[model samples]
Target: MESPLEPLLDGRTKGFPAAAGLLRLGQVGSMGWNVLAEDLPLPLAVLKETALRHNSAWMRAFQDLTGVALAPHGKTSMSPQLFRRQLDDGAWGITVATVQQLRVCRAYGVTRVLMANQLVGRQAITYVLDELARNPTFVFYALADSVAAVDALAAAAAVRRPGRSLDLLVECGVNGGRAGCRSLAAALAVARRIKAAEPYLRLAGVEGYEGSVPGPTPDQQERRIAEFVGFVGEVAECCADEGLFGADPVILSAGGSAYFDMVTSLPRQLGPRATQVVIRSGCYLTHDSDAYARAAVRMRERTPAIASLGEGLRDALEVWSYVQSTPEAGLAILTMGKRDVSHDLHLPYARVALRPGRDARPRQLPPDCEVTALNDQHAYLRTTEGADLAVGDMIGCAISHPCTTFDKWRFLPIVDDDYDVVDAVATYF
Candidate 1:
C-alpha cells in the first residue's frame, strides 16, 4: 500500500536521494539508502530512529513521574507525523503558537489544540471559530494577556456564534518578557474581562512562558522562574476564587523547552483547585545538543525527581554535510550552512565524521573541532592541529535549537543507528 506521505517524496525534496525517482514514503527503507554509503545527497537532515523513540519514552516517563500533562509545542517540528508520535505516546494535546499551526493539527484530525499565543486578526480568528463550529469534538484554547485581545476574541466569537464558548487562558508575564500580563493585578483584570465576555469568551485558566524570564545567573534564573510560575498559579487561584474559570478542570499552562521542571510545580501550588497542569515543552521530543542540553544538566541539579529518572532526552536530530572545501589548514568548509541547520542559539556542533572509503564507521569529531561560522550555503569548521579531516568526508552535526532546524526542511529522513533510511516525516512549515 502506498503511504499517505508518498506524495511528499520526490526528486525535488531535499535530503532524498535524487536518482531514486518518485518512491513511496513506505519504500524508503527498502531502497537500501545509507548516509555512510553515500546513497543520499550531502547536507541531509535526518532523525535517528532509536534516539527519537528514546526521547519520546523518556518524556512519557517524566510526565508520569510528575503527574503533569504535556501539550508539547507543535512549532518545534511542525510535522504531523511527529505530532502523531507524541499523541500516541500519551501527550495531553498539541500546543501551537499560531492559528496556522492549529489549522495543520486540525487538518490531521488532532482533536485538542492549545494556542499558546494570543489569537488575533480577522482571518485567524475566523478560522478557529469555523473549526469549532465544524467539529463538535474539537477543543481549542488560546492565550489572552490584555482586555483588547479578549474584546477582539469576544467580538469574533459573538459574531460567529460557534455554539460553544471560546476557551481562553489569561496569560501572566513578567517585565521585559514576551507576551502576557506583567503583573498579577493585570492578569486578574484580563481573567475578569474574559469572564465578563461570558458565553463568547471563557476564562478556562491562566498561562505564561517562564523561558522569557531573565536572570543573570542560573540560581537567579531558577528563582525568577519559580516566582513567575507562582504568579501564574496566583492568577489561576484568583480566577477560581472569583468564579471566573469556565472550564471544569482549570488549566494552568506554562513551561517552554527550558524550566519545565519548575513549571511542573503548578499543580502543587494550586493545591486542590481541580486544576490541570500542562507543560508545553516542545523541544523535548528531539532534544538539542547546545542550549537545551545545558539546561537539562541544570534541571537535574535543581529537581532531584528528574535526576532520579534514568537517562534524560537524547539528541535525535542531525544534519549531515560533506567537507566541500579544505581552504585552510585549520578550517574545513562544510556543505551545510544557515539554510540547512539552526544557527540562532548556537552554531551546529560537529558530532561525528565518516570518510568516504577509509573509515568503516563514523568517528567522534575532535573535541576542539567547532563550527565557528556559517554562511548561506557553507559552514566554517575550525579543526584543531593534526585533525584528520578532508574534502568528501561526511560530517554529522547536532543542532542547538530543533525548532529552527526543523523549519529548514520540508521532509526529513528517519534513519537507524547505521544511517539506513527507515522512514520519513513531512513538515507543514
Candidate 2:
C-alpha cells in the first residue's frame, strides 16, 4: 500500500518532488519536513538531533573527567526517549524530584532511580514500598531529614517483604534550601533513627544540593558549594565508621549543573569504600546557550576543566511567533506571549526572521529592539530608529532556561543539521 506522502512524489505537487520522494521513502515524514523547512504554522518545539547527541556525549565526557557518575535529573525533558539515551550512555540511574516522576521513569522501563527529594506523606511512602516490592532489583533512594520521615518509611517497609531494606540517603541542607538535615548532629541523628528502624531501611549515605546556595561572587558560590561537598564527605566517613552500609555499596550523590567540580573533589573526604558518587545534573542534557553558556564561562575561569566540555549545543529551542501588529513607526507586536518562552531567568535571543518559503536569514533589529513585556497571546517588542517590520513575518527567539522552556511544551520536533525536521520528540510533562 502506498503511504499518504507517496502521492506528492507521483508528479502531483509542483516544485516539492524531492521532499515528496524523501517522505515516501520514509526518510522524512510529511509533517516534520513540511513544518521545519517550509515555515509552516505548526506551534511546535524542535530539538536539533546533532545538538542533542552532542550534549549527551559532552555530559558523559564531563562525568569521566570529574570521576563522578552522571545520573541526570529526569525532570527537565521528562521524555522517555532522552532518558533511554542517558541510560544507554552508561548512566548509573535517573534522578527525579517526586514519586510521580518515578512513575514516569518507570513507564520508560527505567529501573534504577534516585528520588532526589524526600518521600513524605503516607501515600508517597506506600508508593515507594510498592515500587520496591514490584521491581525487586529496582534501587530507589530518597532524602531522609527527620525521625518522622524515617519512621514512616520503616513502618511502610515492615508491611512489605522481609529482608528487603529501603535504600535511603540522609539529605544535608543549608539554611536556605528545601529539605535536608540541618546540622551534623541532626544528620547523624536521622541516620541513627534509620539504623534503629533497621531491616526495613538502609542508610545509603549522604546527599546534598549545591545549586540552591546563592552568593555574591563565584568564589563565594564555590566556597558555599564546597562546604556542602565537605558535609557529604563528612557524612560518608561517619556512615562508614558506623558500619551503616553493611555489604551494599554506600552511595554519595550531589552536584547540580552549576558546580559539579566541587562535588568531584568529594572522594577525598569520603575516603575509600564510598563506592558510588552520583552527580545529578539535569540541565546538562539540553545546555542552553544563554544561562549555562555564561555559567560555563564563569566555571572555566575558576575551574578551567569544565570549559572543554563539548560543541554543537546551540540554542536550538526557539519560539516562532508571527508579527501580529506593526502599531507604531518602529514597534512590532508578536503573537507569542509569556506562555511560550520562559521569562524568569533571562530574556530570549533573537535568532533570525523569516517569510513564507523564504530561506531564514539573520536580520539585525535596532540596538534597542527589546521584548518589553508579554501578555498571554502577545509580545510587546520595542525597537529603535523606528524601523519598519511587516505583519505576518515570523520571528525566532532563542530561549535562555531550557528547564522552564521544556515544561511549556509537550510535543517537540527533532531537526537535522540544516534545520530540516528528521523526527519529533515528545515529553510527558
Candidate 3:
C-alpha cells in the first residue's frame, strides 16, 4: 500500500498511526489487521468502495438518461482521485467554487473547469488568464451576476489580454438567496454587459442554483424550484436570441445535489439550441444518510428508473469509533465527535456494531439506537435495548451532510465491503 499519497497519511495526520512510516496508507492495518480487530485507532473516517462506485455510476447514468453533461462540483470531496474517476467515467468537466480550488484542479491536470462562482479580485483574474494562456486547450468559465462584476472581470482580464476573451456565464439568483442576479432584467443586463466587453469577456452561458429555492413544504419547494429553473432557461434563451453568447454550444447549468430533477425537468424547453446542459452535483459522488438522502427519494419519485438502480445511492462515508463510557443506563459516550465527523443537517446514525472475535460479521444497530448529541470530541449515543450497550465495542456511524464531513478529513481510507483497507484518497481542503 505504498501509494503516491503515503506521505500525507503518516503520523502527522490526525488518527493515523503514531509510528511514522510504520504503515502505508493502503496497507492492511499492521499485522494483517482488520477494522473489526481494532488495528487502527478510533475516530477513523472510511469510504466504502462499493458505495462510492455505485453513487458515481448512478449519477452518471442519471445524467446520461436526462441527456445532459455532468460537471460535478469538486467542492464536495476535493480529492483529485475522485475527480479523475468522475472525468474518466464521462464527466464533461469539473466545477469549482473558488480560485484556490481551481489551482488544485489544474495542478491535477484538469483541462476543463467551470468556476461556478463570480471571479472578483484582480489576482484571481490574472491567475486564470495566465493559466489559460499557458495551456491553449484549457476551457475555463466563471459566473457573472451583475454589471459591476462583469466590469471588474473585464478590467482584470485586461491585465493579460492575450488575444483571448475570458469565458463567463450570467448567474440568475432567486429572492433572498445567495449570489446571482435576482431579476431576469438584471441578469439579461449582465449578459449584455458581457457582450459589450467584446474581446475581453465572452458570454458563454447561464448558471443558477435550485437547491435553496424557498418553499413551505416539499411539494411547494419542488414546484417553486421548477419555476425558478424555468426562469434560468428563459434567461439562456434570451441571451442566445439577443446574440449575447460569444460562441457556439452555449452552456446552461443549474443543479446543486438537491432538486436536480427540477433542474433537468423544467429545462427541457431550451429552444433546441446547440447547448450542453450540465448539472453540477458533487455530493452524489458520496451520497449521505440525510438531507440528500431525502432528496434522492424525491428524485426517484420524479423519475422511477433511479429507484430501481441498486437502491439509488448507498451511503459511502462512515466514521468508526468505540464506546468510551456508559455512565448512564441509556446514554453511552462514543469516541467520535464534531472533530471526527459531520453534524450539520443530522447527527450520525449507528450502522454496525462489532465485538471482535465474538461476532463473525458486523451487525446492524438496534432500532432504538440513536446518536443524540456531540461535543468537540465526544458523541452521546442513547440506546433503549440494554443488550446493545457496552464499552470498548466498535461501531460504524453513517454521516449526514457530506460536504461538512469531508473538510474535516485530509486523508480517507477506501475500504471494501468487508471493511478491509484497499486504497486511499487525499483531499486538498
Candidate 3 lDDT over residue span 1-429, tens digit each: 333334346677765656545555545333353566665677889888999888888877787678888999999999888898899999999999999999989888899999999998877888998888888888999999989998888887777875688999999889867888888899999999999998999998899998778888889888888888888988988887788887568888988888776677545444555787888989988888888898887888877766556568888999999899989888889998999898889999987888766888888888679999999999998877654758888888988988888898877877788777777778888
When summed lDDT is taken over every stretch of 10 residues in candidate 3, the lowest stretch is 1-10
Residue range 1-429, candidate 2, lDDT tens digits: 542212113223222333233334233344545443544343345677787777788777877787778888998888776787789988989999988888888876888999898888877888778877777878788889998888888887888654578888999888877778878889888888988888888888789998887677878877888888888778778877887664667788888877766677776334457467888978777777588777766767777766667452455566667788888876788877767677788776555566655545536555567788878667887766644467866676777788887887655656676666666555666
Q: What are the models' TM-scores?
A: 0.96, 0.88, 0.94
Alpha-carbon shift of residue 106 in model 3 (angstroms): 1.0
Candidate 3: RMSD to truth: 2.4
Candidate 1, superposed: residue stretches over 4 Å from native: 1-6, 268-272
TM-score of 2: 0.88
The 0-to-1 C-alpha lDDT of every candidate, in the order given, reads 0.88, 0.73, 0.83
Cα lDDT tens digits, model 1, 1-429, are 433244447778888877888876667878878889998887899999999999998998998898899999999999888999999999999999988898789878889999999899999999999889999999999999999999999898999999999999988888888888998788888888988999988888889899999999888988998999888887787778788877478888998988898988885444455888999999998999999999999889888878767998999999999999999889999998999999999999998899988998999988899999999999999997746999899999999999999999987889999888888888888
At residue 318, what lDDT does model 1 achieve? 96
Candidate order by lDDT, decreasing, is 1, 3, 2
Candidate 3 has which clashing residue pairs, if any?
Answer: none
Scored by lDDT, model 2 comes in at 0.73
User: Which has the greatest TM-score?
Assistant: 1
RMSD of each: 1.8, 5.7, 2.4
